[model samples]
Target: MRRAFFYGWVIVATLFVVNFATHATGNMNLGLFVIPMSDEIGISRGLFGWLTTSRTLAAGLASIVIGRLVDRFGARILIPASALITGLGVIAIGSATNVVQLFVLFAVIGFGGLSPQGGGLLTSVPVAKWFVRKRGTAMAVTSMGLALGATTFVPVTQFLIGAVGWRRAWFYLGIISMTMIVPTALTFLRRQPEDMGLRPDGDADSRLGSGAAQRSEAADEAVWTLGTALSTRAFWMLTAALALGGFAAGGGVHRIPYWIDSGFDHDLVSLSISVHAASAATVMLAVGILLDRVPARFVAAGPFAGFSIAIVIMLSADSNTDMFASAVIWGMSAGTGIVSQPYLWASYFGRSFLGTIRGVTMPTILVATSLGAPAMGYVFDFRGSYDLAWQVVVAIYAAAFLIMVSVSPPRLGRPLAD
Candidate 1:
């Protein structure tokens, strides 16, 4: 009975929809636009890559500001505004006539992609506040929407571009943003369970005296302030992992061009991304449930491992089958990144200040991500192949994997007397 009616689940459902729409038209989808834009505008691929870096820098900067706003104001105002702004930004991209215009517009998208309430810490932090015992499950379920969005949107957008053109395809994204996202945020999103007069995990107040309630409340108190959290060993360790996530997963991840260069047609390449997203969506739910039962470090190591192996596979692929296989493997690692990274924070430091913690850590994630696409693009321009760039990615993943496995529970900022 308790499983069916929790309002915390309402936040989960709402965020799932939010993430779905946000990511469907987000950075990941930028892959679909690259060839079309280059074909029409005839810009250097190396120059085209700067757009990803610019957007990453903008989003990183905005995350710091948005993090504070989220902690202070809650999702009530932030989420809706992000929807409108992000949707308009996407629409504007269709009208861009020059590289400067595209850069400016993508910056707008970077802001809206994960703002005070759109994605990342914004969504995860609130859900974290609303579910102590079920934090992993909640974040996992919410993020799965991105996988579903990517799964459907990539193929659909590909088809849209084929039928109508890339400009019309982007207009559809703007329409989707307004029609689907705004209502969901306004209808179901809340700052906390207390706003609706309920306890976290949605237990009845009548049970306040019960042992279960006491334990849940006690667990919630075991959290770190931003200052306290910063001083911990685990903070640096985990943040490092998240940073590498940008380079390994973030940099130059637009595999469409790489595949297109390898001889696959656009439609086949698009299907590979769909398979990747399908696998990612599958892993998010599975890993969420897995983290609830197993140690997070155990599950975390696998992402780096999968990523490294996938890069190796990409280097050897001579057929569409190999491309889909490697893409699917890459998707598995991405699932851990989007889903497990937050779970790691709440598990280690608790969620009381996740917004600020992730806010402070956001730039580290972005700066590395900012370098990734351009690095790959330049490498391709230099060598006419992604083999070397992908090999370099594998090496980084290897180091990150070792770092992840070496992690132990962080020593507290103020340890008890020996």
Candidate 2:
């Protein structure tokens, strides 16, 4: 029976790998194409930024709805369908002839590809529901997909763009996304371990020992409602902090090439992205270990501080060494920032309504990021430098830090009420 829990973890790890692959494939493909697409479509890079904004907006809006759907149905139904839609959208993007077509195709992709509420939500919520004792570690392992995807695919997509045109690269990627995700999702993504006649961690007798006994106690707790969570000051503070962090991170990340355009080489620019992903992965792993043991506010502050320092360095740096430093600092912060929000959500709200709560919170934050992306591009196009943009991002991060510091966890004894 103990082996059953390990099998569940094995499933979680497998899904994480798949999730990471798809995300990396999409992001790296888009980054590689952004400049070429602008040139080919005869649109300003600022205007082209709408492609991402459209995707993010659609995904954000879809999150809560998808979360409800997951609760009503199951991941087995949603994950494969989302993957197929994402693949189809990728194919459509490859076939697009004009800016209008590109926008429409990417919107479809955004709806399918960018719905974190669907894939990650489906994976993590179920896993969290099952494993009480090791929930933090499990979530961290699953979230690693985001970092792994970015690190592995950035270089590959860069190479693909160099070898074939971006269109052909997208075409090949579409085929790959469809072939891989469809089958694996169908086979492995069950609604719960109980569907297989096993508990979350596969303990046939989870109520046996004091250490293992906590599992039943956690499982018996009431799930939080969206309304009750919203009523808490902690929720508002977390949402504000997350939104500000998103704005800052999105603004800088979407404009990485603009910084490179100032005087850096393409390889160096790509390396910055890779470093950012790598650092984020490392930080997330560290935070995963700390999340259960430490206060949530400190975890939130660590990333914001890292981001602030990185931005300051980036704004000051004129050389490769400085850029490298900037990447490491910012990358680590970005990683921690990404993982910490979800950790906080679980910490503050509990696992029952995680999907719905996250669904609601994610869109608001992503929309901020969506707006930030194009706005930063416009800043570059208008101001001809990322100098002003970096300063703005630094301020945003500062605001997020302040918000986090002011917030505290909800009182432990109250039952979550709608």
The most accurate candidate by lDDT is: 1
- Please write out the lDDT profile of model 2 over residues 1-418, one tens digit for every residue: 4762356776677667666757544663366577777788787767777777787777777787876766556677687888788887887787788988878876787677334422256566666655555666777787787777778777777887789988787877777777777788788777655545556557663334543334443464555778887878888778788778776766653545766577788877887788878887887777777876888688878888888898788778889898889888877876776566667777777766677887777778778767877888888789877778788888888888888977888865555342
What is the TM-score of candidate 2?
0.90
Query: Per-residue error at 263 for model 1, in Å?
Result: 0.3
In each prediction, how many residue pairs overlap at the backbone (N, C-alpha, C within less than 3 A)?
A: 3, 1
Q: Any runs in candidate 2 off by more than 4 Å, and if so which?
A: 1-5, 113-120, 202-220, 416-418
User: Can you write out model 1's per-residue Cα lDDT over 99-176, one digit (the tens) per residue?
Assistant: 999889878877864532223766787887788777888989998988888898888888888888998889888888
What TM-score does each of the candidates earn? 0.92, 0.90
Task: Please list all clashing residue pairs in model 2, or write none if there are none.
Answer: 5-201
